[model samples]
Target: MQHKNTIKLLFLAGITMLLASCANDDDTAFTPMEFTTPTYETNLELLLGDTLKLNQEILNLPENVQFKWTTEDTVLSILQNLEYIPKQAKTFALTFKATTNLDSISRTYQVKVNDPYDVYYRPKSSESSSLISQVLAYNPAPGQFINSSFGTPEDAQKLVGSTTNTISLGAWGGSILVGFDHTIENVADAKDFLVYGNAFNGLSEPGIVQVSFDTNGNGLADDTFYELRGSAHADAATLTNYTTTYTNPGMHADVPWLDSLNTAGSVVVNSYHPQNFYPLFITELEEVSYTGTRVFPVVSNSGFTNIAALEWGYVDNYDADYATYKGNLLDIDQAIDADGNSVNLRGIDFIRIYTGAQVNAGALGELSTEIRGIADFSMLE
Candidate 1:
């Protein structure tokens, strides 16, 4: 009996010790680890020639954990999962996988590519396969000077429309145009732009009128000029007074002696000034012919009656920033004379019509005012 009891006790002790060893083994563990993907925000839904960044944060892993990266076949790459770039574009499926210590996690990212000048050209018209197409509408560069080239940031904010007017007094069947260049550096789209021009031509009226740049930016009559008689006379320097008249087939762009002042085939833009030295030049052609005092009546909400057609005319002819005049044309048709003949349209382009006419509602006619902007068409090729 004693031997049996001793044997039984030895067996029980062996079982207890085995259980304790197993529990101790269970408590022994490898190093703990954790992982989390990085997070960031993109300023745009679509990216073009721009760059994107991926920000990540790691956690609870061995300080010496190894990192292996893989990416898609694309124009640009982060080479690692942190930042992947889709150089060109695609409705792409992209994935990123991270593996460490036998534990792996993955994520995906997507973005679209688009033109920055979308406001002016979206779903492009047949007229423009490029990023931007022709933009119409312009304002005289405040104090526009002659023989000089200059631009403003306001000139880059293009104007968009489904269609343009088929009729006008200046340039007919308006076809918008613009060019861009900058004087300073450090721009968002360096390939963006700096200068701008807008123009249109009306058939038989204002045949051609275009905004051009001299490019020197000095506000002096420098680069582009008209050779009149012999000397290269800059177009305009002051804005106090200005006039435009077409010259006959007489002058060329370079020669001056043969320059035609009248009865020729070139345009003469004359300007008056007091403080400025550079005159602004605008290319034009012949269109409408006129003789008798061409009257323009102005009408506006302000109840003024005896206003004359002048820029700095009446005291109450003021509004937000500048004075504007609009008129009801009692007559502006293709005039036929007493002989049943098209009043032989003589002057068919921009002409120096006297501005001393009477205003309708007031004395000066009502003017149409709008926020002027320019659109570039280089991308529409």
Candidate 2:
């Protein structure tokens, strides 16, 4: 019996030892690897042709931790530090992993690489023309001048390389795209360019202006165009995504139109200038559609129909006679994206002007924006 008790006591002692060993093992279990840095930026921006360095010291990681960086399908680096040079302007998503014997941690970073501000900048020289070098596009809405003096693409081209020549961007939503021989720099607290228009004291046909830069170095205006925020941009009555579709009357008569707001109207033909109001250049389509911001015109029909101009920040608004006669001095600082958010542009390569009003004055005529010329303000004396 004493021998049996001894055996049981030994078995109990073995069980206690096993429990202690299990507790100790739980206390010393490995923890997941983590970054020691208090705060780190996950999004970064850099210019193309610039070096981006990632240091392990910033992570405050352990020396024994293994590091790996990968992007897309390829591994970029396996060292503790990574040095990257981007050859193209784009956004890169990089995944970084740190591993230990028992655990691993990973993080993803988005890096945006932009082209240098001056990469597409064309400096002014003796051969640089102050006026626009080319007319990239011309699409005029239905108006008195649609088939008369200013509807053809050639008429729009006449404004190119000359400041004295003018082209009427027919009624609402008519637009013309023009480019410069050199980039127009956005000087500090100064106007960058001028849009010439025939705005007088009582007559103001406002035009919305947009600008774009050749980010791809392709020398084309295929890049995104940012609108220049005018004073009326924030007005309660202003329609941001206004669209108008004009159905070809197919003859020399009033051009019928419908808008996004379910409103219908016509570009009334005046007896003074009688011609087809529909654009002759737009022969391919039975209906031409234009979408843009529309500003309500303040018209008074006392003895004569008169349209009042907004305060400022438009192409053809009557502000001062001197500035009106010369051209509308435009500042690049007023650029805004489609969401009406302000955009900071270093410079611009292309300029677009479009008619912003859709009012039909009694006998005076439909309000239309006109472009005489475009010039770099910095290049002028």
Per lDDT, the best of the predicted structures is 2
lDDT per residue as tens, model 1, 72-163: 55423333334545455444544544455556555555556553322111222345322223332232211212122222223322333311
Positional deviation of 156 in candidate 1, in angstroms? 13
Minimal lDDT window, size 10, model 2: 55-64
Worst 10 residues of 1 by lDDT: 226-235
User: What's each prediction's clash count?
Assistant: 53, 0
lDDT (10s digit) by residue, model 2, range 1-381: 999999999999999999999899689755555566756799988877568898654343445788899999888899867898987789989888888666677778899998866466777788989898999998899888777776678889999878777788888999999998888889889988888887877788999999998766788888889999988898999998899999888887888999999999999988877777888786445889999999986888898888887777888778653253467888899999989888888899999999999988878778999878988988885
lDDT of each: 0.27, 0.84
Give me the candidate number with maximum TM-score.
2
| Segments of candidate 2 deviating more than 4 angstroms | 1-112, 321-325
